[model samples]
Target: MKIDENVCWGIIGCGDVTELKSGPAFQKVEDSSLVAVMRRNEEKVKDFAERHHVKKWTTNASEIINDKSINAIYIATPPSTHLQYALQVLKANKNVYLEKPMVLNSIEAKILSDALKQSRSKLTIAHYRRVLPVFLTVKELLESNVIGHVSLAEITIHQSKSANLIAKIADNWRTNPTISGGGYFHDIGPHQIDLMVHYFGEVDTIIAVDLEKNTVSNDVVKGFVQFKNGIQFKGNWDFNAEEDKDNCTIYGMKGTISFSFYGDEIIIFLKGKQERYQFKNPMHVQQPMIEKTVGYFLGKNVNPCSIHEAAVVTQIMDVFCGIN
Candidate 1:
């Protein structure tokens, strides 16, 4: 079922990711507008509303969720609050644009899945990169077999403890396992893993282990994914490394394709020739996905990213962190 109406949005957490990455896209998308925003900090929320030209701001999340005018709610809060707020939004008959790692664990994913089944509203996970041009091009190249019969893939992300790649928050909740799930792996792995699942199909088996354990979170995580398509993927994430490095390479019978998940360039190598492709992300990185989401919300198109697709990523992270 579709809304058949303009998508009026209420932001549940107006934090760093919303400043430019996604907040403005709600208004920029056709037939969609950000009507209100909510944050625990009254001052910050008010400031954000005034600066963004939004009409309403609140310190209470319920105010935004219960607002009759808000037909959709974007939950940008940490992983811990995702289930509570998402359940409430669905119960209120409001559509949801949930942030990634959809839930902390498979248990929460199941609970949310059940709620979605009983609700009339729709939910889309924020695995926004799949819609970006660079990734789409990579998907196309792989589909065309530009890299021949794919056999193996490697994903390596090594960053120093103070890596700028890691978003800095006041409370540092991202490193808190109870809040962000595992650690840097849980926070960043979903984006890469979701793309893997998007590029490949489903997972056949997965095995992961933590290399360095800390009270807050794991500093290093290594995992292997075996896809049913007969492709094997090995991934390693190190938060306490000597330097910063981010790249994923897919090897095939003919050559290989290498690219960075957070960057705009894609490179393909075949024998002696090397081809490069570059893309410029929109000023608002999430705008493209937001446009797609708006279209899906109004029944103009199919869901871009579904809860089930995102649940698979969470399940992978669970294994990576030795949760089960």
Candidate 2:
């Protein structure tokens, strides 16, 4: 573990997500380079490496894991394969960057947690929102009492069944419980919960939650959760809703703040003086977090996000999904 010239990156699963949501950031960020990439499809790997200008590409993950030049491994595969690839990356004595919802449930989380504890390499999760400028600005706003002392919080995420990323799956791998570990609820639920943890604290209790699934619509989940701060909260995630929406409202003693989960705008309603602040995310949304990870490995900063943090996301999600 030497603080050397630059951090080299090896990406596993150079598929859809890697195209622009993250691929270019390895090179776009300062002092980090995507030296290698791997995918199950040879044609896709070749195209990704060539398009991203990565020096090497391979169909086998072992090639990326074993390459001496690759000091960091980015696991961009599905949730089911996160733990497996993470273990392999750690076993190779390289730092690991894992996808969100670390695993299916608390059971799988414990397995990955134990492996991380045993490994010599460092580990981080891709809760990219934690590094997004919009979220960070909101954190500052809350801390500065922009909305006064915060107390109650409410979240509502509803959308049409067939218009989302998961809906586009060909073989429909995203909704298949066996391959994706759950339906769209489990797939897209992590980003929301993980960000809540960042704003509030650990989820203390899932008071009560209900899950409804049907053939013609997106599944619906309704639940109430309490954070460590005793913040009373209620949230609903319904893919079956007729209206499309993504929103979270935090009510303070003085006022309220509302914003969308995947958008770049925040609205503050303080004393009826409404204000809106907007910030655009980078083309590669993961770049800021990836930059922080590179800095962590270079020994310049603390770890940004951890497997345990993502484990908490899965842990809470399991309760809402009635898994545990």
Candidate 3:
């Protein structure tokens, strides 16, 4: 297959995330351009295009997928539409930058997997946290044995009904199971799960439970993950909690390291001493991953995150929510 020399990009869902987290980075990356953007709302999409300096805007996704000038398509739509739009892009022979929680469920992932077998187009999941400096530092510490013989990881992600951590969206589709696949956990858990698998290894077994299942969405969940490498993970997520708290701590034989997934600092404790590492996120938090994705689409680097790896996250969440 001939590699595309430059990645002319098109965005399928130019929503709030695109405003600063991702849309601008496409223009900032070398050999990449944000040529077009699409949203169901013509006014919003046109406004986004004008503000971002993109030349084209549309309400129809087919325009972006079928545009020959666009070698890569970024699909940031909700989880329910990921599989459909991704299949269309692949059929058009265009590379895809798919958002995380890759599909509504594992069944959709199976369908996407089958479609991928017949297409030469490449697809990368947006588990963007993998490329962040704070996460990279955590990986480095584990590799360097800064926290020796790591045995366990404990997580707490408690938030009230109106926590600021949850993205503000109209109609709150993120909390609707039919649209987001699960609940708030489904919306944000993919990154946490992906990071764990990235740092520890493949999952060996999963035991989880949710407080409610008959409702429109399940908000409270408890899960335990046992990685093949002997590292264990225990977590609790309560969207109806009274306060907001986000923390993850890894315990090891020599010491312990703790940090918040949404924060910019890592604290380490050992031998009666403590060390803290801080980081500042870029204006476009997703730029690092987008740059890597552009290189990957142009045949310069490997995929930042693959569909198969991302499926594990959905699969794990399925068990956590008792949907598997």
Candidate 4:
């Protein structure tokens, strides 16, 4: 089915993410409107619909999927249900915008791959950093050779020790492998892997080290990734660390470039000179990408995040976690 002049949207599992970073932005985009929202909690769904001024709310997935008014569906649920919801939407002839950590394992990712191969419907993942202003600048600098030929890069993501301690309680979905796929690594690793893959090509696994957290979580994960172009990536994600930081640094012939994944600060060092750049995030962080998705639905350009690009990250995580 072709996109209509207006891209009406329906959202599934309208949770915390839909509250700030994504929901309102759907209506703010030109030629796009949030027509329907769904969640298991009837009260929450009604509240979200009223707050966002969305026209419809429901507790059943099929209601929105069958609604001819909605041409696109956003799956905002946990990783466990992403594939299940996405297949129904696609089979109903609607485009999809999925939250990251695309699916729990490579097997799920492959099912999505095979489904897309036989359908004309489109899909985009929520790797929003792909279009953020600061990241776009970093991409520009890398392409312009701000740091000669890139050789080695290092990345670290650390959270205060107490964060996990607080989350280890009963029924915390973030720590449950059945629901979250893994702990903080599976949850936050997608952003890092997707961004790295955006700059370089596919990654080959060198080695991965895993450490246990309380029975609920895998607190520490470190790995070495090598790109076909010979660039080396060394990364560590520790949720039980003493400090809270998210940083990535790239080393090259001329100098080094450093920045944070969730922060606005970016620094470049070259030829005895150091330059720093800072910016604020948009009120709704996903607005830019949402606008782009609206454009794609309208056939204005190619999708921002393709299934193939997203699958690579999932494949890497599956291998790293030994999910096979």
Q: What's the lDDT for all of these models?
A: 0.90, 0.82, 0.88, 0.85
**Tens-digit per-residue lDDT, 225-268, candidate 2:** 88878776787888767878888999998889898878889999
User: Count of backbone clashes for each model?
Assistant: 0, 0, 0, 0
> What digit string (tens of lDDT, one per residue) describes model 3 on residues 1-324?
122678888999999889989999999998888889999998889898888888999999998988878888999998999999999999998989999789998899999988988999988998999999899999998899997999999889999977898887767889888889878888888899899888887999998755353244767888899999899998888888999999999999999999999999999998869999999888899999999998888789998898888888888888888876
Shift in Å, residue 141, candidate 3: 0.5
lDDT of 4 by residue, 24-116 (tens): 999899998888999999998999899888889999989999998899999999899999999988899899999988998888999998997
Candidate 3's displacement at residue 299, Å, is 1.7
Q: For every model shown, what is its TM-score relative to the native structure?
A: 0.96, 0.94, 0.96, 0.94
What is candidate 4's local distance difference test score? 0.85
Residue-pair clashes, model 2: 0
Better of 1 and 2 by lDDT: 1
Q: How far out, in Å, is residue 47 in model 3? A: 0.8
Model 4, runs deviating above 4 Å: 1-3, 163-171, 210-216
Clashing pairs in 3: none
Candidate achieving higher lDDT, 1 or 4: 1
Candidates by lDDT, descending order: 1, 3, 4, 2
